[model samples]
Target: MSEFDAIVVGAGPAGSSAAIRMANKKLNVLLVERADPPGSKNVSGGILWGNALAEIIPEWEKDIPLERLITHKGTTFLTKDSSISIDFRSTKFLENHSGYSVLRARMDNALANSARKAGAMVVTGVTVDRVAKEEGKVVGVEQDGEIITSDAVILAEGANPRVAIDSGLRKPIGDQDVAIGVKQIIRLPENTINERFNLKGSEGFAGEYVLSYLEGEAEAGGFLYTNKDTISIGAVISSSKLREDGQTHSYDIMESFVQHPHIAPLLEGGKLEEYSAHLVCEGGIDSVPRIYGDGYLIAGDAAGFSFSNGLMIQGMNYAITSGIAAADTVIEAKERGNFSSDSLASYERKLEDSYVLKDLKNFRNIDKVTWSRVTHRAIPKIAENLLYSMYHETGRPKKHLMQMILESSRDSGMSKSQLILESYRMMRRM
Candidate 1:
């Protein structure tokens, strides 16, 4: 911990990717993680999006721990006793696949190992206490009682960032800026999961739900992902909503969701294997802070690199892309013998040209649209009622479709005008 070309704090996807990229360029990069083995402290709902990894490392499959390749996908809207979903099941969709279901414990270790193999010195059980700076420029990291000098520092320390915040690289995240993800991994036989999800071999389905299973006091949603022999099911809620409710824990909501009519049958015979929780960035583009500064760059969740538009939740993709951009900027700075903010400003340009920032920028209003009551309450109820009217059979007089729709809307306690307005709002923003 004395001197290096760069210091990367936290060995999650962002940190490890950044380290690997720089080290591959022959830079002496030192990557440190407080978790003894890395990824031990991380939790995810699986389903990593994008194929940026293949571009970063042509042979990365050998370095990533994959649980299943996604073959079926859907998003469901759920009310207290009913649900409606839009699904796509195909073998041809991204056949080679850009996404995968993974467990962080295995994935992170493999990524960290890849960085080490790329010639970066990797250390675990090491906490970076502060960014050591002099004359208004970051020059190293402080760990324990010593300073490790470096030309620049990269912070990819997940949602709750310490060094990034303490070093003045970014502002402390607020309750509204984050969502708490509580998840449980349930174990079932591989064959059983395949049978239940209608999959063959290692193919699996991933689903996210705008659940009304829990009390409506706090707005939240749920996700379920199929691993090889286990299923990851959980819910994510705004932290401010959780605190304002102050009546139930996220785990309790997860419990109720598991016991719900639609979800219960899916996990009928499974053993609970893991229960975990973590913070997720949900504030969209506006919530993102300045990503680059003199001698410092922030990547991953620490930089608010996450997006959940109630359909697809993307984080890892942004993390990897931003990590690569950071490494590219640092490599250029080292080459130019200038580690100033001006030199690293290229990172922003790199991201602007990449899908990472473009997607975030395009969906900047997603938080407003997806977090609306339309997603969780009114829309689901409306859809459920309409479907019930269409499918329910009885020996009665047949009614016109328009009349049936009106009756369904009234039964769901929504005026036709309200439904039209909500639909229009969603269309306008999303």
Candidate 2:
């Protein structure tokens, strides 16, 4: 048996951040990972946004091995044959830095090394079977039929939180609350990426799309991110929708997205280098699990901390912020020599007070609206048809723009009254 002040399960951003913070405070910490190495099983669209990361490591840009800084952001709505895109490029995003694209494998390995250097013992290639409890209070963790006692345990076990669910601290995540994300890293020459996306040096672009190519009942969205020499393209679909429709597989939706007319040209000759899949917690603030209990704290995806508005998908920054907040609470508890639920409850309070919970709460309805069949089926088709009708050069005299708009609305199977009501409601909620 071994003992430490704190034992952190999972070596992704959340766990690494927690361990690094605790170790920096001079707490004896143990970071356990199931993979043969840190980040070996991690996959993401790989954008680290916001200043939440700088709180953990102030000099991350100077110390960490980051791939590219994102200076350009684009959002595209893709129809079968065309795409509507909005792009924003600014020198402000380049100066002082706002976000970066990273390879999780390399970044996480570096984070684990940083934690080790901060005096945390990192143990890889080990499976943590369960968390040990004493009188309904978590006291340690059990791994591979052995026990390692600690003052408290921090569970950062990504999307599928087996330990947290089994401990009865959280309900099992429902399929409706989850999304299946499939990603592929394609190898394109650096100059090719620069030419295709109009980038220079280590600056890169990221684009998110609502794809119209998945013509079936599958409601899905796609994303493309530029790295140093590779571009990550992927799609996320609601798992409940997929299962209910009896779809053969999710990859079919991804294939359709890649082959969409507006997307195919960018990937004309790129080689697929790696493929991976993972679950995303898309259920808004309503789905957050119990954050603190007995002698344990939960952070990151394990606690359902992610926000996916129609325009942005943010998870990494939330994970980093929540992880740091949880560590701060634990460090306070250690100071008082108390690991009770009362002592650790501040973690939940702080998280709720932070922008992580505030933004999720504010945009709670956006997730429902974004995934609603109305937006998925009607919005794109209506817009595309309206544009086609207005832009087509017919021999007949052009009708007034208002008359054309009404005709297009009717042609798209939407009444003016219905459009007005829906648009008003969407605007109010969003």
Candidate 3:
């Protein structure tokens, strides 16, 4: 017999949620983490979108460590010296509580504690070398030359997915499927944050910027989120783009972002509190690996359950939902006394029925839409030039909308035909 009914690797949203659900169902569970504290290794800033957490812990908002509730959102098309933004603020977002700003360390630590309270054996500061297999089926995990046996194993090892790749559970993630995310926590006064961002009470703001201003052939985007007493600013750049440009690095892009005239004032009085960098998935559905097999399953970033649709980036909620679905599958499998691949295949069905896979499949081509030169460069420049023409004061008569648009399109270095074709493609894909 196995020692534990299920073993969950990593302690982020996915692993911790899996452990909690399994433990609550009275299945002996072991949740292992490489970092001493559950989320200590994670990059500091992110948004937890959706209300998936309420499914597992109904009163989570009353206790979970969230920085602030997002009540405002903005998206900017940015050039080197100009920008045009669409900003919206709604009380509905706060009342319904759709999203919150989170620091992973506090959030993950709280989740691990919840798992412990749910009666799972939570272990930290230990690295799982690989899943222990017998007869081509995973039976447990090996760590420090020792074997810990389990009836099933759930891999929630985040974006790196070393165990999944090493164990032949999935192919190695290619550069096209990955991006580098770098973030920093800048400490600011609470009232100052409130005043600068026009926030009230627990209301927070999230803004995304297209980083067309970066030098070289780099494709990247920037984000700035308002926390209670700090600001979270970061950029996600294509790994392959970074490799092509010998001069520009992720940090250099970050430096340029924070110093931008539009972004600098909000962070003027802030002091740097923390900095972190990590790998993120950008490949949508095509990059996802085999998620379930005999006596084993994968969830969260390990299974590539992340999505970006140019306007919004969502992962944590998908992670939470995927984690819960993984646990539920194991519960059903346990009832039938089967842990075979055929039994665990229910995991995929659950994801398909849920928004996790449905949304991914629906927007699978978003990567092509957002990563294209037209979306990142030509569009932003055209927007800036057209807006500049409209707003700039001159003694001469102002040009009409069509004239300005034609001039902007000509200056953008793309033909009208190319622009129209790309716009059609974007409309169809998005």
Winner by lDDT: 3
Candidate 1: misplaced stretches above 4 Å?
Answer: 411-414
Q: What is the C-alpha RMSD of each candidate to the true structure, in Å?
A: 1.7, 1.7, 1.1
Which numbered prediction scores highest in TM-score against the true structure? Answer: 3
**C-alpha RMSD of candidate 1:** 1.7
**Candidate 1, poorest ten consecutive residues by summed lDDT:** 407-416
Tell me the tens digit of each residue's lDDT in model 3 across 1-430: 9999999999999999999999999999999999989899987348999889888888998879999999999998778898789999997896688789999989999999999999999999999999999999999999977999998999999989998898899999988778888899999999999999999988999999888887688878888998889899998888888888867988988888899998998899799998899887777899889999998999998999988533467888889999999999998888998999999999999999999999889998888888788878889889888888888989898888999999988867688899999999989998
Measured with C-alpha atoms, the lDDT of residue 145 in candidate 3 is 79
TM-score of model number 1: 0.96
Q: Candidate 2, residues 34-123: lDDT per residue as tens digits? A: 987798899989888877767768888777777789999997778777687788899998776878888888888888888999999999
Estimate the TM-score for candidate 2.
0.96
Score residue 308 of candidate 1 by CA lDDT.
63
Candidate 2 achieves a global lDDT of: 0.85
